[model samples]
Every structure is written in structure tokens, then in C-alpha cells.
Target: MSESAGQPASVALFGTSADPPTLGHRSLLEGLSRRYPLVRTWASDNPFKSHGAPLAMRAALLEAVVEGLESPNLRVDQSLSSPRALDTLERAARQWPEAELVFVVGSDLLPQIQRWYATDEILRRCRLAVVPRLGWPLDSLQIEQLNRRGGRVEVLPLQIPATASSAIRRHPDPQLVPPELWPVLLEQNLYGLRSCLASRPPLR
Candidate 1:
């Protein structure tokens, strides 16, 4: 965990488009739990990207991951899900009125944060914590832009796996996500998982 200049934030808000909630998501939640007193996550509908599963199922998958972890500090709160991050932030503010909110995001989103709705207001309201992704390196220029826009950015020292939900959607590998999600994925036939299950060889 990277320390920011001021007092530690009271909560870490991690909103994801958890289409299938991969192991990477679980690992992130675990890491956030250890760092923040409270960690809130939700399966969001990204206006920029189309989803393979319904928001309900996606949120359920996230719930499964949170359940498996059994960490008191972490939870999946679907009510916070929103297409616009600013709306989510506002809702969270009302929910945890006295808590200092840290808006958590992946390093891949660093460049795109500037274009989000009410980006300046979001930055003003909460500190930004960017979790490093395997392929996406943090850009100084993007960081400078965020700072110029009144953002307090911190790149957390956490090793998130290389696994990506997009890649899992492209190739539904059971090993890529947590086993807790397998039954739901198979039963629901999500992300063309049935074909992948059939193609796998029997266990030795």
C-alpha cells in the first residue's frame, strides 16, 4: 500500500464492470480490505463498453467473490453502481457522510479519467488510488493532468494479476476466475462458457 500525504482515507471505493468477476477482482478486493478500513465495490455499467452479462448477474458474481474472501472490511454494494462515476461518488458520500472516500481505479483508466462526467468535481471530492495493472504502465503526463484537475492520485503498490475480464470473455477459461463463480457461469451459460467446458480434457 502506498501512503498519501494526508491522513489515511476511511474507505476505498472500487467500482468495476465485473462482467464475470475474475480472480483479479478478488485479489484487488483483498488488497483493498487490508489497506482501507472499509472497501466498497459494485458491478457498474460502463457507458463506453458493452457488457456480455446483465448487471444483476455481474453484481452477483462480484458478491460471490466477496463472500469467498469472508473479509469483514469488504463488501459488494450494488446500489452504488452507476454509468457515471460522479453519481456513484455522490451516493457513497451520502452513505458514508463522515468517511474520507478514495476513488479506486485501475492504471488502465488513468488516461480516461479526465473525460469522465464531472471529472473535476469527482477529483475534488475524493482522492484517486490507481491500482497497477500488468500491461498498463502509469503515465506521468496523465498524472500531471489529473493533478492539474485537482486530483490527489496515489499509485498503490499492489500486484494485480495479468488476467482480464475481456480476455476471459474472448476465451472463457475456468482457471482464470475463482471457483466460487464456476457453478453460476456454467449454469447460466455465460460468456460462451459451455463450449469451453466441453472442450476441456478430463482430469487425470
Candidate 2:
């Protein structure tokens, strides 16, 4: 978010519920790492959403997910709190003052940016990196409007299936989420399910 002429500008931030970090999330991180030198990822409880699994469980799963990936730029930041983009950006300012901040979001959240809490503050804080969602198209006109409102938006070159954590909670689909984390989900008995498939003991 630093506008100073000489400030370093290579860090990007992606925050999630970390409840069932999906396949699309993996794609987003992969694309982000290719462009940014450092990608900071964090997980928190979304107060707007329904009840979620324990943060510890979600954070552990997120750690495992990152471990399975090959992106060296990706860093799991489990401590980012308040679950607000503005809050996280402020935290970044205190921790890494020279690093420019970019908030990575899904296309579904693009148009809703201005309507979010402290929208004007968020617009002033950082640029946005938006990931595409299947069946949900982004509007160039809308992006233009956001730009006019003093927001910088960058779209990542990735199209991923739109499978949300809510959908996964209702129906766990192995293909919709990261394959490597499937067994971890199974071992945790998450999403209020006790399926025999998810009950098997973890492989030795």
C-alpha cells in the first residue's frame, strides 16, 4: 500500500477461512507466486458465514495444503486477524512497511468490494488481485468503475471451478478441493459428517 516512490513492491496477500482450502485456491496461489516475490496467506473465522470448523483444524489443514504445493513464495500466516482486508493490510504495514500489499480475492467478491466494511479505506490501502470463478463472469465495465473509484484491480490468468466451502460442507467432493488435503479432511471428521470413507484411520 506504500505509495512512496522508493518502497519495495512485491508482496501479495491472500486470506481465507482456511476451512477446506479448495483446488481453486491452489490455482490462485500458483498464479500469484509466478508474479509476486512473496505471497502471504492467512486464515480466520468469517463472522459473516455459518459456523465453521475449529481454527486450529483449519490452520493445520492449510499448513498441510501449502506443504504439498511447490510455490516457495507462498507463506502461511496463521496470525492475521480481524478477518478484514483493511485490518490485515494494517498489520502488514506494521510488520513489513516497505513491501507493497495486494489483496487477492475471488471474482465473486470483485463487484462487492465497494460495499464491504470500510470500503473506502480498503481502496486506499492496497491493489486487488482477483481470481476467476467458473460460471461467474467478471465485467470489465464494473472493473472500470472500481478503477474510477480509486481502486487498482489486477485479474490473475486462471479459471477455476467455483466450489465454495459451504458447498463442500453440504457435500464433500474430492475433485472440488485440493487432492492432497482430501485424506486430511477425512481424518478430521469435519463438516458435521461421519462417513465411513472419512472414518478410516490415516495411512501409516
Among these predictions, the greatest lDDT belongs to: 1
Those runs of model 2 whose alpha carbons end farther than 4 Å from true positions after fitting are 1-8, 192-204
- Best-performing candidate as measured by TM-score: 1
Instruction: Indicate the TM-score of model 1.
Output: 0.92
TM-score of each: 0.92, 0.84
Q: List the residue pairs that clash in candidate 1.
A: none
> What is the C-alpha lDDT profile of model 1 across 130-164, one tens digit per residue?
99898999898999989988899998999888889
lDDT of each: 0.88, 0.75
Candidate 2, 1-204: lDDT as tens digits:
247644447688888887778777777777777788788787777877864688778877777778788788787887665667788888887777777688888887777777788877887888877887876688898788788888898888876656677777777655566767766676766764447345555333
lDDT of 2: 0.75
lDDT of 1 at 166: 97
